[model samples]
Target: MQYRKFGKTGETVSALGFGCMRLPILNEKSENIDVKRAEEMLNYAYEHGVTYFDTAYVYHRPMHQGISKGFSENVLGNCFQGAKREKIFYATKLPTFVIQSPDEFEKTLHESLTSLKTDRIDFYLAHSLTKQTWDRMIQMGMLEFLQKAKESGKVRHLGFSFHDELPVFKEIVDSFDWEFAQIQYNYLDIRVQAGTEGLHYAASKNLGMVIMEPLRGGKLAVTPTEEVRNIWKKSQYDRSMAQRGLLFVWDDPAVSVVLSGMSTLDQVKENVRSADSAIAGTLSDFERSLYAEARKAYWNRTVVPCTGCEYCLPCPAGVNIPSNLNIVNELAMFGDVTLSKGNYEFQPPSERSENCVQCGVCLTKCPQHIQIPDHLQKLTEQMK
Candidate 1:
């Protein structure tokens, strides 16, 4: 496997990190992991040179069914034993949602360490930080907790995984002395949460950057639509859609590692092959253009033509026009209606499409001439 320098640490880690969130499962149950199959996949990946193993306290739990967490850490702990355990870089997170106070920090740390069968964690993160959770963490003395954890030799390095707007991302990065960060990034999500600008800013601070959701949660890895496939055909290099997606993230020199949550042995083998050939700054100008073209092709498939411009904002009915429509566009682009529907639930009740009064005020301001109220009505029905 190819290796890259991990930012200020100057330590060389495998270009590809193994994310333990999506191991194979049985009976359509998230908590009922298929251990034998998962063990084989993990063993193959480790033998092929993937050393960074990332898990979390809440990984492999049934979110809807209310199952207890830590199955992922237990499974991983069972897979590697003897000398293998010390060689691997164990990375896991302190669940942000469960952190109600400063006291919960150490309690949770010991829980994860016990689950992993490890005394010290190699890389620990504040998991899934948003603006609200971040503020709560600070107010509860996160900095002091981290310092104590490090000084006690329980956690070797500190980092965070983000899922918020760029401004909040920048605030979190600047607020702490972080050793690394993980963010959602892909060719299609160039301007999404912690996009290109966030990547460079963290690198500027000498923080090692780990890329999560490099395939946009497996959307970019699937068979492309006809329009996107035609665009990929023009490229001189022959690669699967998934490999192309991964290489796009690995192409950046600033990235320390790209995490892939492999569920099958075939995926482990294929990703290992891709990582072996991953090099920074190798994409030709023309090849890079294909990514941009592919992105546009996906956008073209969206039902709404909203450019996310706020010109139609300040809705008379208090509806958030751009935000609601963007969720529909995300469904079209990624072909994941269930995920898109879940995304809609996060919107404020006052800003939801249900609040649109079918007023014609936004029609005059919209440059695309989209039927604003008509789409809002459709969205309300579809999401329901």
Candidate 2:
């Protein structure tokens, strides 16, 4: 396995980190983690030199249960016994959305420390910080809290995982002296939340940039359309779709580590093999251009131009406009209604596209000028 200097932190971490959120689960329940299977995968990753293990307080929790569900840390504590725990750099997040008071900060940290059976977290983050959450955290003295965490020896490094506009990301990065940060980056998400500009900005400050969703929540790794497959065939590298996606992110010298939420031992093996070749600035110009072409092929299949900006939200009829449209776009791009329909059904019954009442309230709000109700109606018809 290859290692990279984890920017200004002066620590060397494996190029590939094991993200424990998507561990194998039993009986189709998110919280019902298949412990034996998950342990096997973790052991495989560890044995193969994946020293960075990332989990969160809410990783495997049921969405309906909100932030209260936190079984991931306990599972890790259970799996890594004795000396195995000391060698791994455990990275986890504090559930920023649920903190009701200043006291809750220490309360959550203590709970996480106890759950992980560790005295100090190698890296701790403010989980999934949006602009609203960042504002709330600042008002709650979150920066001081992080400083205290490191000072108290409960956390070695302080950082955040982001999901907001690049300006908001820059604001948070500049607000505190963070050691590292996590952002969603991939070939497809170049211009999305904390895109290339944000990646470089964080790097410019000498902060270690940990990349999450390098596969776009596993969409980029899934079986692609025939157009996308043909484009991959043109690559002389002969890599799998998953490796191609990973390599694109790891190719950047600014990326300190790429986290893959591997659910199976096979995935662990495959990703570890990819890490062997994760040298920075290695992709040829021809290989780099393929990603751009593949992106266009995927975008060409998009039926709705909705950028998921969430401006057309709080649908008067309770429909989740962006989510519904995203499923439609996923179906169009990948031609996988079976998977897309499953995702659509996963949303609350109230948030389903079928709940759209054609209120026309969202009609004027959309930035893309999407015919909101018409598309929701079409989604409802297609699902039927």
Candidate 3:
């Protein structure tokens, strides 16, 4: 695996970090993790040179059936049993949703350390932070808590994983004397959450920039769209869609690490191979144009630009806007709507668009200004 300088830390980490949030599970249960399978993949990745492992409080967390909050630190801790712990960097998060009090900070911090079977975390972040969470963190004395953690030697680095608008993201970045940051970025999200603008802005300040969804949650890893294929066919270099997605982020020298939640040994092998080839400014001017065209073809796919931002939430009528629009997009993104439609239709009418009340409240809230009621109305008719 290739390595990069982690911002101003003067420390080096693998170009590809292993995201342990999606380990293979047994019996279709999130808690019933198929550890043996996971160990093989994790070991393969580690042996090949991946040095950073990222997990979170809710990773593998099961709030309901067939769902995963995926508190993956447990698996990673278990996998790194015995002497395996000293070989790499361990990164994880403090769940923002659980931060209601100052006392909860230490409680969770210790719990995380215990779960990982480690005394200290290399990188600790405020997981999935939004404007509200940022304010609450300060109101509840997050600074004191982090300072204590650092002084106590429980946390080596401070960071945050963001999921908000650009302004809010920058606000949080500037508010804290943070060491690193994790963001959901990819070729497809150039103008979405914490887009390229935020990426470069954070990097300019020399924050160790770690990217979570470099492939847009695996959407960009699939076979290309016809338009995308046409563009790729013109390229002199032969690369998989996943490689293209990953390389786009690595092309920028500012990015420190890219996280891939590999679920299989094959994925581990494939990603490590890509990481071995990653280099800054590897994409030539022509290839960059191809990237532009590929991104355009991606947008042109049968999917809404609704990025599941959840800004327009708590619908009075109980409509699940993100899920519906995402499924709608999957009609094109995955090239098949059978599973999407099945899942969408499986939701009770209340959770589905049939409950849209046409209040227009969500419209003003949406960053994309998506006509929520209209989209729901159309989806209701189409799904029926």
Candidate 4:
């Protein structure tokens, strides 16, 4: 229910925006979105003052399929039916990453509009901009396309969502006069791609910063290891782990809106309460130390500390090299070998760690010089 000024736009957005990536599903199947439940949750969030709803072109798939499938946006539109659309700002992305030509940009935009059943998008962003995509956008005259959209009143605010290295992030930020930008930020990813640095840099330009993956794709909010739980207890704050994690992000003044992809009413309520009490400068020195200790505990247990510099990419054997390492790290850190093993085994053979052919293609590219093939073999054995 708390609000913050969305950069210099003078629009006050709820600190906790509703992210529609993980709407309630039927029988735990992501593809079968429980539309009735989703509608109820959306209405509940709206009734409780969550005015910002974020969806994307690639959410709810298999059963629903496609970006404009209407499973997500349609449910939201139904919930807000007969209500003032202007009071609730709708945000979606143009999948420019998948565009092969300049004309495709307009096609994607019109598709998104039709999907959401809205003519004007309150906030529109270039989805998942890598360095390559940014350059391609320029080469294909994407700016001209955006200007045209703005002139037509289709997109009110222009921005981008990022997933590249810090240097490239700076390049993209400096490339255009963006109204806002979205980045993946959380306690565990402070130094990762477009971490706190990108957030601060964008804010420095007076551009509103929208945060995604605030829970690291729901990792931080789940149950923690004994060490992490002890650290949370020591913090002496009467809040759950999810609240603590959210408070950390919202406490930073640079953060304009912290998005949570909640699927259940309980999650919506918990996050809304966290947002209500999340004030900057509320964490004392001791509380901050507790958070640092918790982070160390998490790092010591779950992840291999890979910086994801993509030096270990392009595995010759088709192994999802970084993703496998991350899974191993999560299992080790959380002391949940069963969950980790299940996750690893459920993946397709091409993505499994055992698929590593020891080709050493990932090693030379690795900035950390990690023995990737060897470590992958070890992880595969351990999981087995």
Q: In terms of TM-score, how similar is model 1 to the real structure?
A: 0.85
> What's the candidate order when arranged by decreasing TM-score?
2, 4, 3, 1
Each model's TM-score? 0.85, 0.97, 0.89, 0.90
lDDT of 1 by residue, 1-384 (tens): 999988775667899999999999998667789999999999998999998999999898865543356599999888887799978899999888877778889999998999898889989999999999998888898888988999899999999999989999999999878999999999998898899999999999999999999988777887777788899999998899889999999999989999998889999999999998889999999999999999998977889988777899899889989999988777778676667676677576788899988878999999999898898898899888
The predicted structure with the larger TM-score, 1 or 3, is: 3
Whole-model lDDT values for every prediction: 0.89, 0.91, 0.84, 0.81
Q: Which of the predicted structures, 3 or 4, would earn the higher lDDT when compared with the native?
A: 3
- Candidate 2 residue 249 Cα shift, in angstroms, is 0.8
For every candidate, C-alpha RMSD to the true structure in Å: 4.6, 1.3, 3.3, 2.8
Off by over 4 Å in 2: none
- Tens digit of lDDT per residue, candidate 3, span 105-214? 88888889999999999999988998888888888888778878988999999999999899999998898788899999898889978988998999899899999988
Candidate order, lDDT descending: 2, 1, 3, 4
The sequence of per-residue lDDT tens digits that candidate 4 reaches over residues 1-384 is: 788888865678988999998898886565678988788788778888887889876567443233333356666666665555667998888787668787788888887787777888888888899988888888999888887898899988888899988899999889887889999998888987898888999899999889998987777877888778878877666788788889889888998888999979899988887888767677788988887788777776644667666667677788888788878777776676766775676466678888887888887888777778877988888887
Q: How many clashes in each structure?
A: 0, 0, 10, 5
Candidate 2 colliding pairs? none
Q: Provide the global lDDT of candidate 1 against the true structure.
A: 0.89
Ten residues in a row with the worst lDDT in model 1?
A: 61-70
lDDT of 2: 0.91
Candidate 1 off by > 4 Å:
65-68, 304-327, 334-384
Error of 1 at 291 (Å): 0.5
